[model samples]
Target: MNQGTPRLAVLATAVVIGAAGLAGCATGPVDRRALCTGFDKLGSELMSANGLFDNAVFASAGDLADLADRYQGGGLSADATALERISDADATNGFELERATSGTAKVCGHPLGLGTTSYAETGSGSTQANGGYGSYGGYGYSPPTESVTSTAPEPPTSSSPTTPAGDEVSARATLQQQVDTDRTQVETLADKWVPQLSSKNHGLVAHGTTYDYRAIWADFTATRQAYPSALLLWSGDYTSYTKGDFWVTVANQSFPTGAAANAWCVAEHLDADHCFAKLVSHTHGPRGSTLPR
Candidate 1:
């Protein structure tokens, strides 16, 4: 995670809330009201991109493309172009899209991004105080201050290690074997979960990858004091979504609906970045599904 910036989920939420690029706005010139209403519904992943072509940014391409498809001939050619640019920004190196987003807002008679609001980081890690994507704070999700590829906790290193290299190699091999085995089990579980969760309609998802099922489950729920009944899903080996590293945490906590689950998230302090409302339906694979209505 970049210490300088919030998590990508938070970034996406920020983009959705105020990135200014028209998402599913009305079929006309990009206006503030229409943009505010429409931005949060699409292209969040692209909005989250910080001008770098990496896995997280690239992961949103498919979703953004779908949104673009919906807006192809909707009298928002500039908006459509912006969406297309953001959708393909990773592949075509078009990360500099201010003209179509915030710049467009300026043309639409608004200097601010989305509306007359602002975002700030709270000490508790919540992004904002107003009713925006950054406001949801939640339990659990103690993201490591540093990025990690494997599930193993870091053990303190000795100034001079006396352990045998052969022994260390054997241990690593065993760990890798466990990882492979765990991934298969997680794969099966993820396949089973997609349709099941989708059938329910909506869920608050804490998206992540790399950790195995047991670790992911504990981290997303019980360990951090989140809903224990939450379901865990993984992105299988095959998917164009963000290099296919798996694990998505869906809190099964009950709520009629708030921001399509945003209210529940706020109650738990789960922001759109750390957690977002998802349909949890047939839109499977590593990337998960569309935002809830």
Candidate 2:
């Protein structure tokens, strides 16, 4: 036979003898031959039980029946109970291991090796050790820090020119004039379109004057065509009892005026009446009107 096999057999024999001696010390004198037989049987049962457990835990369907047979041949009844307990423990642990593995794989976007936590480092050098089992790059690795260069501030070049008070007043007047011109254009467009509506609806009341939706739409369209810098919000179907259909709405920031609101509707390409009825200004009132309950 192989030299290693003999050495292993000798070592096993020595272990069995030592175990029996310890048992004898605990109890009374034990028959060496009987104890040796028991040891042999116990060793075989332990090996078979362990193999069965490993197979079940790893989802490997091996010759479990054969292993079970060897386990049954063990000297004590407790051996069977011990085997069952081991199998139970392995099954429970295996289920937990599978769940933990799957969860970590999904969250970390990678598979974890055996006995590894979800936050375990991926080969990509990103550490996921800080978070829980499913957390990626938890406490194990540090984030990269970017180097910042500090520069001395440059001295002021020449003294900046200061505008006279009269010049500042002129600039303000010019800005107000532009504002007024834009407002007048918006009003004139409303006047042209106000008569087209079937209902004698008053124009949008802002800053004390009513502006027609069509006029606002014209001005909004013109502005968009010219600058194309207006903020566009989303438009979609809005169902309500009073309003038949909801259209697009736009705003200077979000939804500043009726014109901006109508602009949003037109951009979204929704029906005008539907968009107006569904506007935020119309939503505050009672179920049928613009007044809040």
Candidate 3:
């Protein structure tokens, strides 16, 4: 046996250990950006495939919850937070219309007329007679006796039944107003959150309108004003797109931490109306540098 063989074996073992260590580093936990990117992509796919973004209930898909759990386990706290927020929004579902009604309205009354009756005498008569006064003699002449008769007309009555006015038209109008307001409230709530959630989870953000490669390149160059050190490159050509000539540009900006990347996006959004950001993998190289792995 050669004395140098032992030393060579030891060196070889060291080299193997060093190579293994490099491999371990390479395979370590992915960065938060990559995890968030994956999470966002997952959510988009779920929404596209199942219409999950359209107010899907939490129980509708168990896979959503599982993906969130996986992201959380990977130490992508931001990704987990976003997933939870979006899921909560998605679980809100449709708005429930209120069944309330407006207060009762006063009814209008109608006028009524009444009649009465009574009795009244119309004519009268009297009678007289001269009798014994003339005792003996003169039975002169007896006064003629007289008779009388009378006729009457009815008087007005004392009381009469009255009818109240109707208010059907006013009541119906009020109820209709209340129903419309309830419907509006429900629709407003429905519109509020779902669109915002979709926007948050969307991966490819379209900035300014791009007619050709030059336009796309120009837009990307403008991004340098916000992310000065970012790597600017053309994304690709879309000659077959139905929306006319269009292209995409990618700005590869590196940040030390996930929070910093988010902050950069926020800051850029504040000034530029057309500026948007998307999470990409660390190994994505730069746009045009190489196809993403």
Candidate 4:
């Protein structure tokens, strides 16, 4: 029994070694190029979402806040932040991507390619005379048991590595289209509202003091909702000269472009005395900040 135990132990050791060898062969290499490809796709999709948001107009402070919260809550932000850090740390443009790919490979229990982003193929070709052609080379012909055939070393074929630039270009193009559409809608709404100011008797007119800014804001919001791609450009006072009721005129409005604002004044048929484009940077603050009513 003791002699048998020794033989079994030896056999177990051999099995373990063989198993390890098999495992090693199974986990070939990590493909960093592929990882970069996936990362690029993810980043582009996230950017597209952001662009969509930027071009959209929210109905209220709540809607604006909700959109902001959604963007932050989405995993895209975290993934993009991580990718940005990786890109920053990747001095060689190849090292960090390589290391990240390697780390992923270890976890996945497989080896991937350890090289720059490139393609390669290894192949060889050979032409040999087997018996002869037609009937001579038919299955009936029994060739020599040992036949010498020389194989030619075929040239390696490779393709250029894919780049992330194309994704960025596409994203940019999509965003620009959104911007143009949004701008046009805002202008159209401006044209509609300018005439309504007097007929609807909605805002601070020729001699009115108290301005229903919120109502006007709501009107613009509704107009923007009609055009889904319009952005939340503004919802504030359009002041020309400010003071008390005696000399001050505060006609508050919201608009996407300076041209639209100026067009509002034109549509209202107001002389240069009352309203003008209140050109300044307008942004509804972060998700939780005070939103313009």
Candidate 5:
């Protein structure tokens, strides 16, 4: 070997060792003290940002500190961050609502018409005068006496077995008729509207309004402040943005009629330009048709 080769080998070995040491240090057990300190800081920031500490459950500083310790110990940093975000959003929304309604709204200002205090006082006096008070100074209201009202038992009435058979046939016929009618209406509506609204700017990619169904659902949910419903339908099957999953659902509900559905869409704050007010009949299938009914 050349005289300079040994020196180069030694330097290379040292470099490798140094890199390994740095990596080991980086991935080593976390410093409990530092973790606890970070958690305390995060808790303070969250409490100040959301004012959750005003509630008795969250008021104790020690309770927050303990929660921080537990979260850090469990390696739940992402969950902690998400909880903070939700709390902050709720606080911001509540603050805005309070500001908007302050000093302008009053509740329960009118006197209650029925069962007023004067009526109660007079009734109580009348009851007292009637010796309704017991010796123990308690009200002597007795349970009502049982009334024995009786009538002759009528003979048992029987219907022929044919009656039930006929009823079953009638019910089946009605159900079949309804199904056929619904199917025809669904097909007609689908054929009519599916081609026209398929590519509209509602973020749908289907053959018609069905393409924008999820977006429409989401918009309706958000407009109505139906977070739970939106979460249930559009949130999909994801854990959440911060958790292992990429998203979380928030809400879900079905409307009874087209007008009711439109009203809900409007209340939920969906865009008026999106043709949200239009009623579309939905068929029952893998990909339901959103056609005008």
Candidate 6:
């Protein structure tokens, strides 16, 4: 080989290193303004998880790390640091998780609810840290007191077994706030539990404005959001959905016995006609017959 060939190789290596350095420079810190949507979504989800008392929190440890990493990359040093602690905390330690969650709430001011360990809002704005279970806020909880009230406006009670006998205004607003807040989770549950239909299911459930989601969530709050639930997202567009289309249903599997499930419906002041035991198994379709109501 020529003596100049070694120098040529050195020059090539330097060029590659210089190009890599330039690429790194080009990919400098992300704009915080551009990160607003993502940051806000993470915050909003955290806040929702914090507010929910008895449901599975959707964010995972990896999700927490992802948000934290984004915060760090986008110049939110404190928030990034706080979330890092949560991501690194002992999974088995409830107190540590709670403390970390509370600490992160103070810094991030979203999922952990500032200065509060309680997931749900009580009259005194109190809730015990249920431990970091499935994800962020509420985790596995034993049978709680049945007197739990929620921020969601309750549907007006009457003798009607279908939708409640409320005016359009009330029906329009029934659990709307709560539904909006937990919309992501509600949809996630539906996608997991029910077969997605060809047409949208919301309009089919609209009782002049009261959608099935609101009616269903109202029932869930009665059980203090214990049982897993979702709306059967079947639209009238399908010919197969002859009966009980676009209905909301809690998981029958959550209850140990069919009697227990029926008893829950009876105890919750739910209409026996609208709220009854249903068996949804694998190989089911978006039809009433497929769901043994």
Model 4 clash tally, residue pairs:
7
Q: C-alpha displacement of 145 in model 5, angstroms? A: 60
Off by over 4 Å in 4: 1-32, 43-181, 188-293
CA lDDT of each candidate? 0.34, 0.29, 0.26, 0.29, 0.27, 0.35
- In candidate 5, which residue ranges exceed 4 Å CA deviation? 1-66, 69-72, 91-283, 289-293
How well does model 2 score by local distance difference test?
A: 0.29
Best by TM-score: 6
Pairs with steric clashes in candidate 6? 46-111, 47-111, 118-127
Put down candidate 6 lDDT per residue, 10-54, tens digits, no spaces: 999999999999977644443333233333444344435433422
lDDT of 5 by residue, 108-170 (tens): 110111011111223212111111111111111111111112232222122222111113233
Stretches of candidate 2 off by over 4 Å are 1-167, 191-260, 263-293
TM-score for each candidate, following the candidate numbering: 0.25, 0.15, 0.19, 0.18, 0.19, 0.27
TM-score of 1: 0.25
Give candidate 2's root-mean-square deviation (CA, Å).
Answer: 29.4
In every candidate, how many clashes are there? Answer: 11, 25, 8, 7, 15, 3
By TM-score, the better pick of 2 and 6 is: 6
Candidate 6 stretches with Cα past 4 Å from truth are 1-16, 19-31, 37-67, 70-249, 252-293
What's every prediction's RMSD, in angstroms? 22.0, 29.4, 45.2, 28.8, 28.0, 16.2
* Cα distance off (Å), candidate 6, residue 112: 14
Worst window of 10 by summed lDDT in candidate 1: 194-203
lDDT (C-alpha) at residue 100 in model 6: 32
